[model samples]
Target: MGDTHKDLIFLIPLPGGRVARVPIDVLEHYVDPSARISHGGEAEEEDVTAHSMSVDPRTGASIWHTDWELGQCDYTDENGFPQSAYAWHRHPLGNEYTEIYQK
Candidate 1:
């Protein structure tokens, strides 16, 4: 029979020798679905790798290190100027999840 688990869990290592048991759904909500480690507008699928994981002490949120960076948003400002957008990192328990974070 196929797997029947309701959700998959990921064991993420954190700073200070702590580990987080995060669910797949939480990961999907915090991580950008389209994010990829790219350069010159070309997606380097094979070379994509996470450098490290840590907690933002100020916010108590988990952070994932990667070469991928977020750029301007597709929509423009009131004067038709591009606006900046931020990349997503793993923050399973962070209370900042919004529609933008959804897959």
Candidate 2:
């Protein structure tokens, strides 16, 4: 119920057509999640406004429902600077059914 306790998670897009969900605690020391998110390169980037993700931490069901203008993207760059790959999903702890992006 408080923002102070909120946490962040990262979703990595895989070339094989599956998303990898990694907890922020496991990546914060090496990766920046924000740097990997963006509205595509369209003249008018499609805004990802509604997202519904539920993870039963105990069961580890990291599935999500996101409403956005879909596009293809690469998750990591050649330098691995956390590219905004079209396959990642972020889970901001405690912000249930949160809105992740605004076009």
Candidate 3:
């Protein structure tokens, strides 16, 4: 798929931690979908975004979005439980996961 006109939508975090994302198009910050990105690699600070949109099932309209981080990890210790493995998912929709991570 080409540009969904939905790429690189971002929320610039404020110093006070009050989250606010502009609903306008800032052409300079758009990340081209076709551009190649290294798999499991760290994206630059500017490329990181923190917003998720949920469309209304019935209306097909974007009814909600939020600026919060959700971390997902998969690692097991010798005991077979969850190990404290950590990493960042720095893709376009990256959450900047709360735990430590490598690119």
**Best candidate, TM-score-wise?**
1
Per-prediction tally of clashes: 0, 1, 1
Q: How big is the RMSD of model 1?
A: 15.8
- Model 3, position 49, has a per-residue lDDT of 27
- Each candidate's lDDT (Cα)? 0.42, 0.42, 0.38
lDDT of 1 at 41: 40
State TM-scores per candidate. Answer: 0.32, 0.27, 0.23
TM-score of 3: 0.23
lDDT (Cα, tens digit) per residue for candidate 1, span 1-103: 2354546787865444467998777787678554433222444333333222333435644454333233222324468565444433332333322112223
Better of 1 and 2 by TM-score: 1
Lowest summed lDDT across 10 adjacent residues in model 2 is found at: 94-103
Measure candidate 3: CA RMSD. Answer: 14.7
Pairs with steric clashes in candidate 3: 87-101
